[model samples]
Target: MNNDIPKAVALRYDRELEDAPRVIAQGKGDIAKRIIELAIENGIPIHENPGLVDILMDLEYYSEIPEELYQIVAKVLILVYEIDKKYTSNFNNFLEQKGGANT
Candidate 1:
């Protein structure tokens, strides 16, 4: 409830299974801390968009992100994709150099 405390929201989208991204989880303060920890532990990309987070915090859990936010959320998804792509490439290169995987 404290404005100074950090806020975080987790989104899940499946283009084939769903129409738009949904707010899978959201919290502030200590709960926010836990959400971030789990995301990092699982290698999920964390995008820092405080203004967007603020707007998203108002949405109900499991609700699709509003249509008005489509453009902004799309940009975030693009960034996440880029980050995952780069990380995957680097990891594959590492495996190749180590003579491990068939990549």
Candidate 2:
């Protein structure tokens, strides 16, 4: 497959507020590039799972993901949460080092 053109799908979920994950974004080619770029700029974790993307692309945007996909989606969300936790820890460490004298 030619990687010159990219493909991506984004999902959003909040267990406390939502019953399941929703498709927040889905795109291919240039749109995929833009979606990836924006995610990077915002520090959101980017996971490349072509198989998962292929399956998710079939679902409609803003609609809750179906029951069958819950397990797979939960694993992906776990990875995202881990990434966020690591990033936050690293950032806090940096701040502590930078504020050594005052802190």
Candidate 3:
């Protein structure tokens, strides 16, 4: 399988986390916890596994995920980045319009 896409996605994840770790961390609040709750609610596989966040991060950094899963991961990351940028931009616009703060 061609590995370039996965590598590029992983690199993007790494750069985003590095550039804005606090924002990323905040956005991930309860995500790991809720994933387990949802899995149990749906009767999905719930093995006695390690933290899903850690697993996913490791996969983002080191694993050669299949193309299908890679696409999902890439799309999710893009969505997250887009939402983050939108939120930040909107907040800045609000502040400017309201004269609440300066950049």
Candidate 4:
């Protein structure tokens, strides 16, 4: 087996939360779902093979994650999920503020 990770794998590691919106929006399902799907499609093996939903849920709540020799992938996913959640929260707050202003 080739020990070297593919270019795509390295690229995924380099992603930051700031890029979440565009990347997530480009996928087929919800942000997290689409991310995992894309990873699998690209042949980045997530060891333990847990379902995508479970992985997403863990990232959302615990903020703690499993250990892996190649942890950069998981870190990237967590960062994106956090950015997505924060954006959603901020948007909701903005709507609430606007509603109060009109009243």
Candidate 5:
């Protein structure tokens, strides 16, 4: 069996208009580390799905995800949305407690 370093793929979606998400960034090994780090720093949600990453890694950056991957990606997007909602709610609550209105 061959062992490979871990990989990561990042995606972007525009819910207002776009029909599909696009491959925003992807990398293996060190670059993968950086992508994950940046995501964490920016409060982006990260889903660990090596199988999905394997499939998405083949796509060119900025290319729309294929229809075959829509179901999987949809699940991930839902998770991200939920996380974002929770974070926003928490942040707003924090601001209110601090006597600062949410902007």
Candidate 6:
């Protein structure tokens, strides 16, 4: 793959729903752009790991990530969790500044 074009892989994980994270989507170039755009539009966190993406790209869509990647993926998940926590904090602060949530 050309390094000039961006690559992306989207993983979906739900502890009660699946044993491991699945590759919900993967693409390069235009498809990759759309994958990223959708993630941004839906407020999903994005992490960059080109080597990991390369390995994941070899896996079939909707397949669980391999055992070998568990540690690496776990780190990514931790980062995503932190990102979510920060975003939630900022959003709550924004709401409080505006006189708290309506509900």
TM-score of each: 0.91, 0.89, 0.38, 0.34, 0.82, 0.92
Model 3: per-residue Cα lDDT over 6-85, one tens digit each: 11111223544343221122113355456556655854333331232334444433344444445555555576567667
Candidate 1, pairs of clashing residues: none
- In angstroms, the error of model 1 at 34 is 0.6
What C-alpha lDDT does candidate 3 achieve relative to the native structure?
0.43
Q: After superposition on all CA atoms, what RMSD does each candidate show versus the true structure? A: 2.6, 1.8, 13.4, 13.8, 3.3, 2.4
Which residue segments of model 4 deviate by more than 4 Å? 1-70
Computed on alpha carbons, the lDDT of every model, listed in order, comes to 0.94, 0.90, 0.43, 0.43, 0.89, 0.93
Error of 2 at 68 (Å): 1.0
Q: Evaluated with lDDT, which candidate comes out highest?
A: 1
Model 2: per-residue Cα lDDT over 1-103, one tens digit each? 6856678998988889999999999999989999999999998898889989888888888889999999988998899899899999999998998899686
By TM-score, the best candidate is 6
**Residue 56 in candidate 4 has what lDDT?**
37
lDDT of 4 by residue, 1-103 (tens): 3323221211223335432212111222355455557767865543322233233333323232334323544555567667767777998999999999999
Judging by lDDT, tell me the better candidate of 1 and 3.
1
Quote model 3's TM-score. Answer: 0.38
Q: After superposition, how far is residue 41 of candidate 6 from its true place, in Å?
A: 0.2
lDDT of 3 at 90: 90
Record all residue pairs in model 2 with backbone atoms less than 3 Å apart, i.e. clashing. Answer: none
Q: Over 4 Å off in model 1, which ranges?
A: 1-3, 100-103
RMSD, model 1, all Cα superposed? 2.6
In candidate 1 the C-alpha lDDT for residue 82 amounts to 99
